[model samples]
Target chain A: MLTDSDSRNISIRAFRIDGRDNVATLLDPAAPGDRLKLLGDTELSAAPASPAGNEPCPEETPAPVLAALEPIPAGHKIALRDIESGEDIIKYGVVIGRAAAPIRRGHLVHIPLIRSLYDERSGHLDPETGKPKDISYE
Target chain B: MNNKTLSWPAYPRKDGRKGIRNILLIVYTVKCAEFVARKIAASFDCPDVQVTGFDGCTDNQYAVNLLISLIRHPNVGAVLTVGLGCEYVQAKWLSDIAAAEDKPSKSICIQDAGGTGASVREGISWCRGTLEFLSSAQTVPMTFSELVVGAECGGSDYTSGLAGNVVAGRFFDRLVDAGGTAIFEEIVEAIGLKSLLVQRAATPAAAAQLADVYDKMLDYCRSVGQYSISPGNFAGGLSTIEEKSMGAVIKSGSRPIQGVIKVSQKPPGKGLWLLDSTPDPHPVQFGITNPNDSEGLTALTSAGAHIVFLVTGRGSVVGSAVAPCIKITGNSSTFGRMSEDIDFNASEVLDGTCSMAQLTDRLVNVVIETASGKLTKAEKLGHFESWVPYKYQDTGSAGTRRCEGTE
Candidate 1:
């Protein structure tokens, strides 16, 4: 992380809240045209495995940023890597919730993809409306 | 932030309390007189003068205590009381308390003054003279120990847990190291954080006290049927009550748990203390009210906090009454959208433009500046919200103490 290449002209599209997190928070909208830095050798796009014939293929050349699939707002999570269904959505080194659906890299990981185990209502927020309801004792 | 290096500007009252800001407080004892009091305070259009009142006609224990505690707050240099004349909680009692403390105070009854217009005029006239007189209170140097800083996080998000509170935690660590009192509240957010907090207790007794707070908060939530975790939290990247609890306590850093204090009760000793704002932890209670952000912030002030650090991930433009709220946001987008309302950006820490330590430095500088009387963005924007909770606890069998004593 202290390497020159890590800090050199990297566009911070999102932040991985912790080293253990499978998702990262976008600092800027990751629109279809925007390119984002994928920290810690986490590839924004994992290349097709060099045709099975090329055994011990040349060392993996790392790509720093990848093009976003859609517009993802700042503060919203984008999958750092592919997350399987029921996998814990980790942030801040703790499991905040679990993914209810499969999440691909650059895909938004929010209410639509994740459901909260804490409350009956999904993830405390209405993703589309952005209106917040209180965590009621009711 | 060394107090030795920085001399905080303050009003050295004869009451032995150092006030960061000397303002004339106009309080309305009931809803009927609130308009007059609001008019009087609004007439000043000065940051030094603020308006707050109890909207209840019948005297509730919590309302009376909140009024009394706010009136006696260290930041108030003088006060003027406005009454509808028939309210159960008399404005005269509020005026008398301020007078007893040697604070210049006056009282006006709307019924006797003939009408609302006259009352507002009378209150306004008295406040003008009082604000002018109190404006000259002697200045004094304040030490860190005399400072009470409150930590609160609202409109939370992923960055709130990772950046905002972490920055505040580092600041709180330094504040406690310098022997100042630091309070982080909202036990309603601490449901699943007991294990994380218990280890930080300075003593076994303190650990029990910390555990008791968790139990009580959980109980209160169960009885009321709601936890503190809200939909906004999920929208901002928080999931569960336990997760929110874990994030919230991070603002207190590794400070050892001091005993818990309740709403309107000052911390008995310095260091880190929890201001439990829920109704008495007794089994029989009215259950806790679902408090808004301002209610929670005002509750923190009632615990003697002179400065409030409110961290928002979703963005809030509010500054509660009595104290100047320093708004901080860990979300870069939110900061961009609400930069004028927000004072500091912890989102830079998340974006990696700065490290957590650097963020802490920024926060400390803002705190020092605010303590020295620099108005926060919220204060400048005039977003003052204050209210007393209608929460009631059974005083029949349990002691009247809402926040259990350190003993």
Candidate 2:
């Protein structure tokens, strides 16, 4: 009895964490060629501090008309607007990661493409202990 | 925010503290005695009994202090300290601390007991008898303020940020509102935002302390050449440390931090406190900055956390030694997949069907039930895994190591 992601159920497709965030999180997986409804809210949050974030689309969002560029998974980020390289990728109204490359609207925001700027360390895990190796200022 | 009030039955500790779970906790002073200590606890076949220990074979004040913290936790009604007999972290000293505090305590060494078999026999006898005596202690009614709830998120995913941790955050806000202590850790999660936290400190001194801890945490991670995000975090949809942190930090709710304390220190008063939960990252030490779930739980328990709320997305099955861990998950798939392991499902919040308050009510009910001694998945499944830190920052610079990718 599990319902899948649809535009009307914006709750299932995407969630915006903060009004200032440029990305939205998908709650369920979707396929290519799927038309989606995205948030249009420029005011307050929809989910209001719930992990659902601000939501699939905000209150003013229109019905499903936007097409999926590719199949997307649940909990992954979807760029609502274009993100230029070196610019901050904002979520929760703060910078989470940075764009290592230019990201177009509707593209999936994830690792490799979007790099973590937390530190300069290479964050390699120790094969022997499964712990992370040390990074230095050098 | 219902005005619905409920009282919890609590076990009184001699130190003027209260405990939700009365435990006959067994400790191994060194790794060599771990097996013997484990055998003694398992041999008792009792859920009220548990085992954990430090791994250092040498004398480390940090290790000993951490051990003392766990031994003195309110949830631990009695204590049993074991050692290989020659280790620097003495079991005798720990036993004395317990006895001085008027707790029923015993100490043994395998090398002194003439080996593993004889030690196990004597240890089991002591554990059983201690459990019997502790059971007879008087009980009292407890409330939210009497509780110290530790918040942690492992196996984190985007759902964890959005719903799993969000639900826990709401719970923390409520707990604080009710005058209870709530803790949210993992400084690596706070990577890019030091001033933001500094602005929330209750006092100038605490603000300094908070900043220091954050700096130390960052340096520690840098010394070890690792960031806090794991491969699982990335694979599960979290891209960067800041991103993961934004999701993770919400679990503490929005409260002015009372103060900051080291991993072994206690929260000064109440409200929300920050635990410098990381092990000392001194360049000469052998342990890393990142602690697994068990280590974190034990540290919190040592700081007097009566219960732990573990919010996981990829779904972790870990339970701690001294305190009971309540599993709250925001992923429906994870919940359904590991139904037996998860305690509360906040997935509906993500689905837009269940409200955070509804999830809070469900979670609180389970916590009350757990406080009354209902077994958790980790307890039911004998998941008493533990980790004691060993490696710390090495001397000087080995070289410039780049922290690139999910290496």
Candidate 3:
């Protein structure tokens, strides 16, 4: 439940599709230290980032505050909870991919950091152009 | 919601259907005839004069069926078939069908016409006269109930599922509720939502049809070792095929799906219909299904869609040959950058600037206006592209038959 005050202070937002989702999608680009107000599918709103000086009021903040641990692009995913290496990275309440390395909460979750379990080449693309790097034109 | 009774000006076809555009379609029977056909269409600056055809020299029933469907599509007012003398799919055969349909039609054989220059001149002359006659064709008032709209998504990002497709879904629901036909294709994209898809069926038969198609799609993907997820999708924040599928399927809306339909087949009744364009499994898996977005749009257009909505979160510029393509993007930045190409920005829903209902209303207005002769960005920019590839899928009645050997 987002309080009137919490809604007022929200400069950035992220959407969590389902309650069981371990990741949320950033609605806006964020840098380290930016607070993301978590918006869920229903009326539930998670607490604002703690480091931004919003004290955790239990009733208003059923979920923990998430601060950007790294620079994340808009439309990208962010880790809502600490994920171990090789653990499934869940989104839409389904395993979208696996964490290639242990990801900290609020850190950017994307290719190279996370790899698709179905397609091995998902991690082997050129990050800048999103083109397959290993394939030859021959 | 107040505009539920809104009607648009549309040409009434001889077959009791309505056409939003009075298109002069140039059909090239083979790759050899393409140059002449394109040259003829290029002579005219009118957007209504467009070109589409198969490139193969040999016979393909699927390709022929698709061509026939295009000739008979409600939007096409006139058709001119061009053939290189020896192609198996004769230009005269197609012209005869158009003539039977009462559409101003003609056929030209390049070899018999003397050469490319002579054939182009003959085609240009016929098109000029035909366009003049079609320009004065009377239009009747077409309501939502008589409309058939199709939707497809490409170059998708995270915003597609969250905002773009969601808005499209809402609009589809409204369209279906108003008793219009809505068709959505790209069955390969629905990777992990078999149960969800089956549950949306309007009848038990439709449910079984959805399940069978879903199973075949999965098997086809497994056989090819490629799901529709692309590298650009990953760059745009989609992580897996299942994740992408969930996003892609949302554009179909929550309406009770009428049933599954094959390519070049019209929905028997009004409501939502899923078009399965996946090639049937064979001893050797051959033609790539929907090699590009244009092919998917063409599939929908061949099914009699008057206008097609192309939702692309990352943005796309291509349009279809028969139906006007309305490009939509949920990413405001992409819409901003590609404003000339993209038609609608559903990003307002994501930005909290507008509610879904409000945005859906605005989208409906766009559709109504487009149906009334307001050109979409694709049409205005002359982005009419169609791809008809050679793929083997049974053209039997929808939901009545499965791919050969699949049973």
Q: Where in model 1 is the C-alpha error above 4 Å? A: A1-12, A20-23, A29-74, A78-90, A98-117, A120-138, B2-5, B281-288, B393-407
Off by over 4 Å in 3: A1-10, A17-21, A39-64, A81-104, A110-138, B1-4, B284-287, B397-407
Give the number of the best model, judged by lDDT. 3
Q: For model 3 chain B, give the 10-residue run with minimal summed lDDT.
A: B398-407
Winning candidate number (TM-score) = 3
Put down candidate 3 lDDT per residue, B147-212, tens digits, no spaces.
999999988888888878877877888899998999998888887667668877899999999988
Per-residue C-alpha lDDT of model 2 across residues B1-407, encoded as one tens digit per residue: 23435677888777778888888889999989889999998887777888889877886665676778778888788999999999888888899998887889999988989898999999989988888899898899888877889888888878888888887877887788888888877667787666667777788877776777677667667767667777666655667787877787878777788876556566778889877665554447555535577777766666778888889988888888788888889889899999898888888876657666777878877877887778888888776665656533221221112223321
Give the Å shift of residue B125 in candidate 3. 1.4
State the weakest 10-residue window (summed lDDT) of model 1 chain B: B398-407
lDDT of each residue in A1-138, candidate 1, tens digit only: 335554456565566544556666676666775667754212211212111122323332233455466778766777767789998766555556678888886678777577755554545456755455654536
lDDT of 2 by residue, A19-68 (tens): 66778887767676555544322322533332222233332232234545
Tell me the TM-score for chain B of model 2: 0.91
Query: Chain A of model 3, TM-score against the native?
Result: 0.75
Greater TM-score among 2 and 3 belongs to 3
Best-fitting candidate, scored by DockQ: 2
Which lDDT value does model 2 have at B371? 79
Instruction: State residue B206's C-alpha deviation in candidate 2, in Å.
Output: 2.3
